[model samples]
Target: MRPTDIETLVQVGRPTIAPDGAFAIFATSRPSIEANRSLSRLWRVDLPAGSPRPLTRGSGDRAPQLSPSGDVVGFLRPDTDGRTQLFVVEASGGEPVQVTDRALGVMSFAWAPDGGSLVFVSPVGERGRYGDVDGLGPDAESPRRITGIRWHANGAGYIVDRPTHLFVVDTPDLDAEPLVSPAPAVRPEGAPAPTARVVPNEARALTSGELSYGSPVFAADGHGLFALVSEIERDRADLRSRVVEVSLDAAGASERVVVDRDANLTVDDLIVTPAGDLALLASSVGDSGTDFVAACIGLHVRRDGAWIPLTDPETIDLGDPGSHVTALADGSFLAQSRTRGRVQLIRVTADGAIEVLRDDVEVTGHAATRDGATIVAAVADVTSFGELELVRFSGEGVGRRITALGRTPIAAIPSEREVAGRDGYPVHGWVAVPEGEGPFPVILQIHGGPYAHYGVHLFDETQVLVAAGYAVVYANPRGSAGYGRAHGRSIRHRMGTVDFADVIDFLDAAIEADSRLDGSRVGVMGGSYGGYLTAWTIAHDHRFAAAIVERGFLDPVSFAGTSDIGSFFGDEYVGVDPVEIEAQSPMAAVSLVRTPTLVVHSELDFRCPLEQATRYYTALKRQGVDAEMLVFPGENHELTRAGSPRHRVERFEAVL
Candidate 1:
């Protein structure tokens, strides 16, 4: 049930299906304990006879894209200074040709249908203006300056703004040009809609106003484009987003909404079905859990004025709900379902009946070819290392499996147990004991988002802590996501009340049950809301010997004014108004802290800024509670996943 010892889990990303459906390309990183450090390589899988083969051997290759014609593969690679640039290689696997040599970072790119061109988005300068919200003064000349009215005022505190629109590249020669030019003028309040105009090399404007749009997909007929438009309304509980279709032939365009609602829903993946309908994968915050639910993933036909859903939501979640559906050229579709925490590939008839095609392998990421017969899936299990598998299916049944890429084993099975929470509710958690047989120091690790769940995904940080000779205990308390709506919403207006007690109760039970856990040598660590919980626990109880709070909010009132999702957090998580904020904020209760703690924050993180960490650090120091602060430069809320490789390693080392 458990690995011999804990090791770092390799990070995998950007899995894309090949045109012929015979294979997939993806990026994988080696495990490292250092902060802000990463080394990734590109790999390809062949569906029938062979395992996946490495296409690029060195570090910094990522965001793999298989060309439309399946003749070439493109990805981003690090240059001399470590900034990423685009590179392309032959489908047969050979030397890669560098495409872009820009000083700014190139994070993403897509191949054009004709295979002679591509489109990409990257930072414009060495110090990009993308995420800068303060606006450049006279001396600031960087193109990465953050714009867009709503983002400017909300100040999500990101180091870089979203890239400046889309850009197109002519292949072979590889020259790039912005797709939308002249940047639409900022319209005044209540102003009449301006006359639509098209700029050369730029796509027609689909939506107006200062809000931003991205994730563009060309229709099957290539006559229209589907893009996601975000509108940030002042004082709104959540950011408003809608999918709009725009005409490609006309200079002026009209848009029709594909998905629109009051809740926060962001499109994650989209593809045109072989039947000429749109299939999409979206993430939304619903009443149940965080609603990471997969939508139709089949087909949505346009009818009357709106697009109608072809696949039923009930059916999508029935056999396998969270799995994505991919359309095949022959009109049949591939549906992936999660059965008992493992993913299975199922072939669905046009009428909606499904037959399990592949069930033995554990599938994570999936991509289908133009024909449904072949599938590229990422497969891994408790003992198996991460790898991309090329799976072929035919009239007979599931076809042969070919390895596409291999990853080092990075996860360990911590002992699983069910403990009683403060309210006597059964809480499930994992306790990863260090290598030594005798009692080891314990670290109470908490997950962030408050509404998110820590599921069966191969997590690296947990293994890292275990390797550091610390017994790590991570639990799903009442408010954690994935359980159901009632459980997740339990801590809404009672942040420090029940949830806090749940952690204490769980730890008490765990220490009593496990002799390998040293109760007196315990420490606590968490990020974002988890950080808030860590701060709150140390202030209210003296059970912990040391604590680390990463980018956590200390004052609900100040957080409401500064955090990007302030309105939503204030209205739902904590009760509205300054009174409730004061009652729930850990900073407001700083006078009670008596435990040693470490405060960590990123300078550019808008979610929970450095000020929040500083406030807690200052309070603990002044109150004679030992404390220290660590700040990461040019990092955002995603410091753990996307920050500079070196800094990420440092942060882990400091806390450990």
Candidate 2:
């Protein structure tokens, strides 16, 4: 693997099964180096065992949703103005007709249970803002009067100025031109124009106000909908969200239900069972807004108008916030669960019974037939980058591979292992060793989310280093997801103690386990949380000869005001105590570092912000320690994963 290999990687996700469980459709994306962006398209595959074929031209298509009746598939694609809009196409095959022409891009959309109409979430700002008209950008807009803590975000700036609201679009009217123009140029005089089924454009907002709403699912009768609502306040400086049910009747609607009562709850994924029970992944931000700081997300179900805990809040992690969850026909729920290092599909009943349907596969996104018989999942592993895997409970064995999106770029599979921590606790991790007889230079890499873990997957970063003749070792320490709650919450207020020791323990054990690893020439490198650990490692123990800290959260003091999630991140992850925060910060102990360091950061990274890298690098240089700084303009904390193709290549080269 090389830096240029980033362009060849293809990612597929959001698999949805058909009503009869005979076919499925999923989205595929590949980065175009020439265009410096990722191009996405939808693909359909016959279930059980079948070849995958392109359904839509690979042109910005994403988030495909299969309608209730399975007569059509609704997806989001860019309009003429590059704003994402709702689109629908025949289940058999044909051109997709645009269903909306929202001023701003559509965030997400779902079909009504009865399949008569669809509901979408979009920013309902005041007219003239966010390109509402033909030609208007932020430069032409007036200043904003900020009153919320979530006024600005990392990638999407000034979110509070135009709160996102929900609107309903019905398809009653089918022979007219599309609500939004087609992506390509207008047809010639003799050519035909696509017709959208009968329906007016967006009628009106079903919801409005300061709070933002998302993850909406329609009721079985299509008379109401359930959505997650976020409420931000000024005093506590934390984000609090809950689930609510709203009457779908635009006029004379007066009923609303607040589903969850836990304060400081961050709702991740929400699903409504066929029995109408609610299952969601959420974590309560304990009293100090830091109680469950580093713990994995827990699963909860609504019973008798009260939220009931289903999965163990500490140990069982049900993927990330936006991970997909399907409600089965028998009242059982299907979801991708994170355990140890693998994300496997699990079946959870209304009474809290869990049965693993698929194991040893990293389930990224999944959808199951309401019967819980046929399951289609997007999986990634050591040998495969990303592809679709099918699993059938009605069959005798695990389901077969359903799609091969692209060629696999990984040259060798990483060896997984578990080593003992300093305190005798077992630490799980993996190592990718280059093909050679002699000892290779080592790179001990750390993962970003102290909560995020290194799993069995084709990671471009480690692959490139190993291909360049370096041994890369990474581990999921005490503060990582997968393992149970005790492991994830072990490092809440103590960032660099046992967690740091667990990482060091893994690195040392890997070097000792394999003779190919050179302990003397070891260097440390990581991004975000990994970056902080890299700086912290060098500051305390100068075992490494060099270091690269990219977008590290160095000082919690300044991070409270600068980061997009700064309102409660610093106080929640680190501590509110000034002394403990400073003592644990990598920047405060910069004087002890002697390793030659290279500090990397994204200029617009609101997560860690550029100040973290600047402060650490400047302090190292001021103290006469060797240090260098490299900053990428217009990039955020997701630079490595979603940055421009050329910028991604440059970042890999920097690591090399």
Candidate 3:
């Protein structure tokens, strides 16, 4: 595939099935190289089996949730003002009506159990913090005071001032007609001032505080909500949220904590089952409140005021998107589980018996029925991009692919390889070779998230390099996720030690196993933690002919202050000691590097920060080694994945 093929690629968001399983609607988005923004539209499938049709035009539509009776679909879309407001359209079809007009915009929302009203989480702060209350723009806004560590996010700008709160919006009758303009003139007799029977499109705050709230799910009674609450103002640290019961009444603002926060726990998501049981996905934070290195996210079910742990945290690491659970008819729940690079469905019974449903294909997004008869998921194997597949809960094969919209056909099949570390641990990876290759020069790519794993999917990085007459080898060595907590924590304090060994061991094993890979012409490259490892590899091995380090966490000391999660990220992964931190950093070994290197960075990348790539590139140049730096403006660490279409293609070109 060519670099421009990035635009041809399509992504499917989580599918939402109607309560009765009559149809399914999901959002499909693709990056537009020319527009330089993600384009999205909602598509609906008349269920059991039917052709998918466009449901709503694109305004970056997202989170399409069906109303109680499944007649209207409520989703978030940017209003004319460019703030994400709630919109609803008849499931059958029609122009979506804007149902909400909030200044700060909706972050997440849930329909009331009765469907008459919906609760959304939106930022509530004094006017002008977001924009002036008057017609003036941002330049007329008031000054802000500095506060909090979690004040801003990587891609999102300063957000500490606008703490999110619960807001309930009563839905206007779908059949209601447009109101007459300016209202009729009042008669001399004053017939109720000629009032218009118009339903308000405004929302009322349900709860108010400096704390931030999100993932609102209405309580079964419909008079309350269960929202994930983060004590950001109370504790300025890595967001640790707890589940609470939020009352809708004015006198009910006093929240009853359902699931209290624990130093060992960080809530990921929360949802109510058909029986009103609250199920949550959370990961262990250890005692440090930030021991976040490759922590496993497990499932928890709260029934009748008693919360029960469903999966063992150390052994079961549910994929991030997989945490969304669909309650089945048999008192069991269906959620996604990640193991060995493949994310598949797993059934968790109320009693905590875990059963793997499918393991052959990785499920990127999914929706299931209450009866467990039908399940729709975005599935991708080694050679294909994600395609919507309809599968039975108790399926035998890949049930059936329902939509051909997101499929990206592969030109060459990927070969999976596993190797043992020198200390006798397993390392996994994949090798993609070009069609006409004798002994192709190899590009050894490493993934970020020492905790994130490489999986069987249409990874463009490997596909693009292989198309350019270079064999691409990438792997999930030690410190990668989907391999249980032990494998992830194995490299916590030993950053570039065994993890580096596993990467090298896997590369060597791949060369020995595949005849098409040229071991002598090897080039190493990685981003984030992978970038750190890449620099360390060149400095320590001196065998690589070239290296490309993008967004590497080179200097731990500097990272501890600049990175968004740097406050505790370094203390957990590396060490708190000044000497030990330096010793473990890749920057310490940069003087030994002799390989030609290309340092790629995004100007707005706050995760690794721009200084990371710049520092590595400067060190290489000073040492008299060939080096070059490429920086993309208005981009972040997610440049390779979510950057502009043109920039992504340019990155591929630079890699070549």
Candidate 4:
């Protein structure tokens, strides 16, 4: 499973249920390692038959959405300039018809309730940031600045012009119409006022300004649109987001919040049940690591003007646990939980009684059919390819395989382990061992969110390292999520101290427990916070033979100024001002580094920013420490997982 072998593992994403519940539409990537391109295709699975058929051919097909009538499927295809446009095809299978002309990139799209039209969001060219001219007037067009499309390198890339407003198009005639328009603010008589043409028949902005609304879902009755609104602010990773109900009739109408933002909870995947209740996936990080346990799947019933949690929090760990809940027509919910490297699909009754539906297969993505007789889920094993599986469950709780919708190999094997860290605390970790053994080199992998966990699930990079003859160990130190709020918050003001001690302790314990690990030639790698730790470890301890710091924090003070979330980190995680920044910075301590280090980052990564790496690389070179810097063009902090295929491959090769 080395980076080179990533081609064999098809990456699946954007799973959508078809109208009749007989099948599901999903997008998967076919990585051509030889050509250095990962081609994505659209696929559909028949639920009762458990068979899948390819809907699109060639490269760059993704974001497939099934029409409400199940008669057609819409998706995005790459154009000549690498921009993507909307296309549609018959659900039964046929040639795809390009619906939108290739111009600007299509960021996201949603089908109209009647299946006769669709609404999509894209950037307007030249009028604003990224050339997005969607809702701007003639006067505002020249300035080329849109409300949401501010370009500050890190923060700028995330901002889109005009806040990703919604636009609708009639499918039959391909006549584009504005559903929501940008709000115009009244200025003083002497002050300058922006002017933009109001396109009466074109798409209009539903909401305006700094806040963004997306993941739109039409209510079962088609009376309103349910979308997640992300309210952006200056200094916080915890942006205020909630489910908002917007009226489809009036473009400028105010939206009502269906779910309130709690300090611990973040909402995702909003859906309205057939019974007229709204359900959303809620994720929460508690006060400490122990309190940080998540409810993998929850059913929120809109009762008495508020959404009530139907699922008990104690029964599931939802934070990165990969639990999915699909609503059934019978009023029950299909809840799938991946526990300790195993996946189980359970049927949760409205009253909370849980019944096992199909416990034999590892269900990743699942959807309940309209008839409620069969459940379509994506299943796969470590060696088996990924495929859409249809399982018919009887009233007696028995399940029978209906069909093998699509076949895809399991990209990797996920396993869990517990090791003792410093102070005798239990630290959890995931280990992916290579096929062969002989004291193979080991990699001490650390997660980015010193607050995030190394869960029991499949990971592309872990498999890649394992396949490269490296035993990979990713641990949840004192500050990883899923343990509880206390555990997660414990790393605050103690970065590079307790967490680093935990890493050392875990490595010592792991090497002592396993003979396959060659501790003497170990490599350490991490990004963001993990990157900060990598640099700190090599400087403070000489145990690691080599290190790769990807978009990592080197100087805390500089990071606080440049990082997109820097203000949040300074106020929350480190709590260090300009005076103490250098004291806690790895670059300030770079003189002690002895291990050979590889500094890899993306030029566009405003999160860590290449400057952090440049500062360290220069210091290390000045101190005569062995180090090199590798920068990927036009990539951000997420380059390791989402960068160009060729660059991503090169990164892994350099690190391994």
Listed in order, each prediction's TM-score against the native is 0.76, 0.94, 0.93, 0.80
**Candidate 2, which segments miss by more than 4 Å at Cα?**
132-137, 172-200, 252-255, 260-264, 287-290, 393-395
lDDT of 3 by residue, 1-656 (tens): 88887776787788888877778888888878888778888999976679999998774998888888888899989887788988888999887777777777788888898888888888776666566466767677767775656556688766667788888878877787754546456477745565543235667877786777888887767878888777544344554557889888866566898877553568888777787767788776756567677778888776556555688878888845545777776788888888888898888887888887667778877787777777788777765665777776333434777887644546567788888879898888888888875699998899998888888878888877887788888888888888888888988878999889988998898899888899989999999888999988998998888899988899998887788777778888898887887778888889988989999999998898888878878888888999999999999989988898888988889988
Candidate 1: tens digits of C-alpha lDDT, residues 12-99: 5537776665667788875443423567888776555556678888677877777788878888888776767777787678767666
Answer with 1 or 4, whichever has the higher TM-score: 4
Candidate 4 has its poorest 10 consecutive residues by lDDT at 288-297
Q: CA lDDT of 22 in candidate 3?
A: 78
Count of backbone clashes, every candidate in sequence: 28, 11, 1, 51
Q: Over the stretch 1-656, how does candidate 2's per-residue lDDT look in tens digits?
A: 88898776888877887888888999988777888888898888887777888889847998888888776889989888788888888766787777777777788988888888888899877767876676778788877876667667887766776778778888533455545444556678998877643235555678887877888888777888889877656655654466788788767444475665454566776777787766777766665554556555667776666665687675678855346678887877777788767888888876778989877867888887778777888888777778888777354456678776547567557898998787789999999988877599999999988888888868888889888999999999988888887887788778888888988999999999999899999999999999989889999988898999999988888888888878777776777898889877888888899999999999988888899888888999999988889999989888998898889988888777
Candidate 1's C-alpha runs over 4 A off are 1-9, 31-36, 78-87, 94-149, 152-163, 167-210, 232-238, 250-257, 260-266, 283-325, 329-364, 379-385, 390-412, 420-424
Please give the RMSD of candidate 1 to the true structure.
8.8
Which 10 consecutive positions of candidate 3 have the poorest summed lDDT? 190-199
TM-score of 3: 0.93
* Candidate 4 accuracy as lDDT: 0.67
Assess candidate 1 and give its TM-score to the true structure. Answer: 0.76
Q: The CA-based lDDT of model 3 is what?
A: 0.80
Candidate 2, lDDT over the whole model: 0.80
